[model samples]
Target: MLTTRIRNVDTDAQADAGMQSLNEPDFKALVDSHPKAIMLTAQDGSIAYVNDQFERVTGYRQEEIVGHNPSILSSGMHSREFYIDMWQSLERDKRWEGLIWNRRKNGETYPQWLNIYPVEHEGGAFYTGVFMDVGELTANDERLAALAYYDPLTELPNRTLFQEFLKARACQREPADRCFAVLFIDLDFFKSVNDLHGHDYGDRVLKQAAVCIQGVLRKGDLVARLSGDEFAAIVELQEPSEINAVCERMASAFRKPVSVDFREYFLSASVGAALYPRHAESASDLLLKADRAMYAAKTAGRACYRVYSAEESEQGQHQQMLSEALVASLKVAPEEFSVMYQPQYDLRSGAMVGMEALMRWRHPELGAVSPGEFVPLAEQRGLIHELTEQLVRCITRDLTRHDFGTHGNMRLAINISARQIADDRLEVLLEPFFTRLQLAGWCPELEITETHLMNLSPRCLDKLRDFGKRGVMVAIDDFGTGYSSLAYLHALPVHVLKIDRQFVQRLGPDSRDSRIVSAILGIADALELEVVAEGIETEAQKAKLQELNCHRGQGFLMARPTPLESLVRQATSG
Candidate 1:
């Protein structure tokens, strides 16, 4: 008594016109011959039809299941929340597919791969479910467990499995015998690899890095990919000296370049370690301390390792207090923040051609907070956008009040962070500031760090190109300090390169720094980019730069950073 509701079509007229269409009986025959079990139900969940395969698979005849709901086959193995989630997906996405356990007519439960989708007919809406028995597919539990607990890209243990291992190892053993260390590994400049090359290339790099790291560890050690470009390892050591030896091996692993499709990438890691029963007692605390130490390694130049220390914990707490204070100050007393200008000079002409805008904050209780300390905190707290907006407002107001006189058309440079560049609203935020600069006949320049410039997203690069089209100049600050590839420099819309103070201060004829500066100037000349020598404190350094044909310079020797009022008065008097 199996039946299907079919739409009324003109078979007689179609035959006269020599057209072919399947009648209801033919459609039913096709369904009966399908290899997989198929069931049709009404919108109200009452079973309407079952194919031959469905009868064979479930051991149920059509007559007995016609009026019953599919819930009759539910094996009670899944929770209510599981069914809720499945239905939510069906309602929102209009289809669902997963594995489920169902009871057969013989009262035996088995796993089945099920797919449910909605169908519309002339009669009404209907639900069709197609399923297959998957008990044999999951018979190999180790393979199934691998899918559940391992990262597919690197074929390493995932964070969930790593945590389970850590907890069992630390808690199951006696406190005295818990003598293992946790190392947090973060790949340095991995984002640049992903940004410069496509994600496929980056994936290969990650796979190779995983192999390199795992090859160095002992058989009992465990390595897991915590997240993107971040990994963790569990190493057992007999003495503290063993920790250094293991970390050095891990650092050496990345020294060799990773080659992917004929392109070579130099990769490195920042490692931080924390020992059990020493730095921390619990697994979670050990992991956290290790992560903090890893960040310290990054701060102290990457490709290195640091063990957890009490002083680092104190610094972390102090940073947290500063972060909270910054949030409060931004909301209540924003006036404590201001902008100062440090003039840049023409080395040959000895005239002020431009000035860099520096952000300053004076906390009433803390006296003066360094930009290095709070700027990063603001970025971490997601308050950098607000800080940048405030900076622009202050610059606009101050410029409006003080006239530059003879230095009217000078270039005004402002520092831009990577987060600000990635923000979609950066254009709108700077539109008014751009207009103000245009009205004053002053040129606006954006100064970005060399490291950030190499890691900019494609969309951010497009935004920078658009800014260039709008007449905003782009300069790479602290040149030669970061791992910038020549290809990126050539591809970027760069107008100037500012030599870092580290190299400029050591500018002697026979010194390596002098040779580096010379090489930088040569590259700039070949690229048609201007060069600015920073930290020109001594006359000898200035003369050396001038002899090398470097034109622009900025340092304490030329002029110190001054308030807007003082800067205007000094320029007018000079």
Candidate 2:
């Protein structure tokens, strides 16, 4: 009888007598060339052999590491239990792959997505381990994580992270525990701080603010930066009666003066608190309740706190529902919703120079919803971008029907918000919206608020310049209200400035107002740009403004915001 024997390749290779003659040298070369760190270890976790990849990764030579334990490079990040579990899993014929923070030979700690696989002999014994570095890629992954959760400037958790924290807080409740409250904090006059001290200083102020707030907050509480000068905090209460104490603690945090760049300045922030279970059951409801309370606090006076009242909660919900409905209606019921053209009257001609396309919501149940209420709601909910696109389409259609501008062309002044300006895809999205219009020589003026220009992104500046070069008119609305007018005016591509209504309203007995008006008109004259004054409620205001050399005026004195149909008639006759 003839006996046939098949030897285990790894066992034979080690002896240089079994399959080592056929496969050992080839396997060794393959392991050395592999991108992953490859190593063979004994059952006691002692290093038997390591590939060149391991040497390159660990900065340790084979001879130095061969007799050493695998823990020679231990960073001590994982607990003893972690190693025990890992060893047991491998012993049980399992593999492990996950993200780990490890220190390098240079003492630089970095994130790594490591994949460790168990290589076994024919008898089911753990033999070798292979792991990919993935450190550089994991570093990028951490950057994305930071971008997702935290504000880069202030280094505070952003809105998304705040919401998650709030949700987690709400979930951690006993049956009879005191309800949690989410405080929405907003800095008073922060925009002016940015304008005066400049953005870099303003950013420092925000960072200091985060530090100050965190210093006052109780342990385990979350204070997150929601948006510009806005913060949200989830506070746990021992009892419902202690809610005011929590609010007082927050108010006291800002009561003291804060110093930035060695300049001591005192500031206060308005806070609005909405209690979970007591005020709201849902995250959206809680946020709305807090926001409405914040607005109420601002209305009463800044630098205070307001708890969400029953009435405020109801009103906020009603408004939220209305906004959602209006957004849906605008998309579906275009026939019902129509644009009323507010005439931008030219002082010289005393006729319409341009008409601003204002959106009006013809609510089926609530009669006509005014732009004053719904427009802002749209802005808060990010529905304004859609509304702006609608205006673009409608304005383009009207311009195609009529010649608007210097000759036969008339310009349509469309109001754009800060969100639209900051949106990087504004230009790309406009392409498809206007591709169908194809309105030649119909230049529409995009009027953005003075406040929108401050602390704007460089991408927005580039977008505005691109629009200017494309023959689109850019106008600065409510120009006198913002202090950055003179500075940002040069930075921005502006073709027009609409004088603030406050300036136009004070023309009767206010010489200071007259001086302001005069200075603005003189500047406009020097700049050779068109100027329009808003809120001409009286003949005196209109006449005074025109005498100041104001190029255009719009108010109840001329005509209110009229429907486009009536405006077309008004424009056609003039």
Q: Which candidate is the best by lDDT?
A: 1
Which segments of model 1 are wrong by more than 4 Å?
A: 1-178, 182-271, 280-288, 301-305, 327-333, 376-386, 455-459, 482-491, 508-526, 547-549
Candidate 1 residue-wise lDDT, 1-574, digit = tens: 1122232434545322321222257757987888789987765456767888899888999889876878778776555655776787887999887666678999987656678887654434567888876443332345545335567788777786677567545653443644789999998878767876889889999988888889889977888999999999999887666888888888888877877778789998889999887888777999999998887776666799888887876676677688788888888888989999999999999988999999999998887999998887787567888788778978987987987775567899998887688667788898778877977888999999998788887888988898889888899999999987777789998898999999999999899999999999999988999999888899999999998989799999888889889988887787
Local distance difference test, per candidate?
Answer: 0.80, 0.69
**Residue-wise lDDT of candidate 2 within 85-104, one digit each (tens)?**
55566447666544344555
Worst 10 residues of 1 by lDDT: 14-23
**Which residue pairs overlap in candidate 1's backbone?**
none
TM-score of each: 0.57, 0.54
| Cα shift from native, residue 210, model 1 (Å) | 12
